[model samples]
Target: MDTPGPRRLAGRVWIVPGDPDPENIRGSVAVVADDSGSVVVDAGQSPAHAREIQSAIRAAGLPPARWLVYTHHHWDHVWGACAWPDVEIVGHVSGQEILRREAARPWSHRYLRDEVRANPRLGPSFRARALAMQGWDDFTILPPGRTFTDELTLPTGVRLRHVGGAHAPDSTVALVPDSKVALLGDCFYPPPAHLRAPDDGPDLAMVRDLLSDDYEWYVDSHGEPTTLEQARRLVST
Candidate 1:
């Protein structure tokens, strides 16, 4: 994969794109560096992907990540935390609730198997992911040891806010105030048809309000980073 450059703003920022799929499920991770140390947003697609992302961050001149944050509760976004056994994880309380619920119900590969059996079109991709998640039975749910309800200020000067977005209920976005860059995890992706019943998604009005933010660079999880104008346009899509 051609690694993207470390696009700098106020502080150093790097976007590590992961395994892209037509479904746009493979989420990317953001690595931010300030004077204090490094901060990684979201894990990657898997454990191995998480490790590779760490190497890429080092190559970009950032120090080891002092924090690992989750954008939401989706498996594709949070599964990589397995690689960072000791990093202090940070995220929204909603995510912890979802993980704990799922852990108690013990949601696992069987759900995907049933999904694939119901929709034959999903067989190949689901099988591939299952194989990639070979040790998923041993996959431990790593809830954020530190969680916030609305917003919190990090020691590194980065600010995190819980933004109930279109994609998931517990989405969080990080702002590097000095640089005017905002790392938006999977906070705004359009959900699949299956998840559109109650149509739980980012409130467009709220997104419009958030877009009015002074952030120049808006980074999304599944694709390339965009300008404030481009992100504002996406609020319509």
Candidate 2:
């Protein structure tokens, strides 16, 4: 619930959190800001949260969002994307398909029912959050304007390399090469394991190897910024 501190790296990249809670919402939205423009990595829980992200971008003297990159098709990650009107949205080709499927399914409703069944203690909070998320109809089916399997570069000189997936079927970790900072979505999070482990799509070993090669600082979608060494240690354990 606390606001995450903003961080800046070498390539004029900034990491801002859209949501910090891990129990209900498993991911934190991030913004990759540079001189040319800003690209929102993932939309947070609601339109208001997405608006807060937009406000943060404006406060930092950046232009309107030029692009949106969905790490995967998870509801929490893509729901608020409608807040950005007409911006080019980008993601993996598989992610595009997942988004279409999610649009047809009662994802939020199912999540609410599952939350109550799994943890009765937090059922009230879960219902409240789920209802808040459902009220946002902006999650229209918007396919990625640009899709890639391996990697893609934005006009602002940010390179989004799809190292491997960890959190979801179409999940990808975005790397800003120049900054040596990687936006490893829900692939990595702080310890004590609050959420269920994602099905093993991209082997953790592959992710570890990818991180070791070029990344120095890693900005996770859930927790605080971590170093490659720290990530390796976490994965090893």
Candidate 3:
């Protein structure tokens, strides 16, 4: 609800921040535009979120993104790809496998049932909303037609790199050469211990390797966007 857009990154680049409390919404979506067209890094969690992103896109005076780069295979970032069905999707091979197995599945309803079975206090509203947001009838999971092991030159004027981090398996980091902004999906920091133990699951060494002084800013799905200098310090800590 924090005025979704016109949040400039550098020049024609901007960020459409996700719902900070995206228990039911989507993740932060990054956008970069040029003469060729615009590109988005990660969609949100539901069709409603996607529609919001679309509004932001139009308000930005930008065309629909030519491509969608999933930061990882998590539902929060990739589920909303349905909103931009024409955009060419990009992600990792392992993540493709996940899409094949789980995308469009009744995974949301299944999870909800599990929760309600354990705790009746959850009530029906939560279940109803979850199902609706899951985009049941037209729900989909689009595997990146273009797969990469390490790096690739994306059509969207981004140097895409497969940055394996403490997050999910198919993490990608996009660096806008002209703007000097790095759009890194949720590949930093660990989830709270209450949600999941601090696995420190990402490859910090890989992260440090990816973190160079060239980028001016690093964008993630949540939290304050960090600068290259600041992110290096945070990584060390």
TM-scores across all candidates?
0.82, 0.77, 0.83
Scored against the true structure, residue 231 in model 3 reaches a CA lDDT of: 76
TM-score of 1: 0.82
Error of 1 at 120 (Å): 7.4
RMSD per model, one decimal: 3.4, 4.4, 3.8
Candidate 1 lDDT score at position 169: 82
Error of 3 at 111 (Å): 5.2
Using TM-score as the measure, the top candidate is 3
Q: Write the per-residue lDDT of candidate 1 for residues 1-237, one digit (tens) a residue.
A: 434544454457767775566443566778777656688888875676677787777787787888888878777777778787557889899889887775565445897788778987666556655655656655666778899999988888789999876678888899887778888776665664455556565456765666746788888776777888887787788
What TM value does model 2 have? 0.77
Ranking by lDDT: 1, 3, 2
Error of 2 at 23 (Å): 3.0
Across 39-105, the per-residue lDDT of candidate 3 in tens digits comes to: 8888776666777888878887887778888878876777778778577888887789888786646
After the best TM-score superposition of candidate 3, give how far the Cα of residue 200 lies from its true spot, in angstroms. Answer: 4.1
lDDT of the structure predicted as candidate 3:
0.73
Clashing pairs in 2: none
> Compared with the true structure, what per-residue lDDT tens digits does model 2 show for residues 1-237?
434544565465677654544446645666777655677788765665677777777777766678898876666677777777757888888888777776675546676688679877656556645754646444555557689988788887666666444456666777777778888776532221234344423356755666666778877676778888887887687
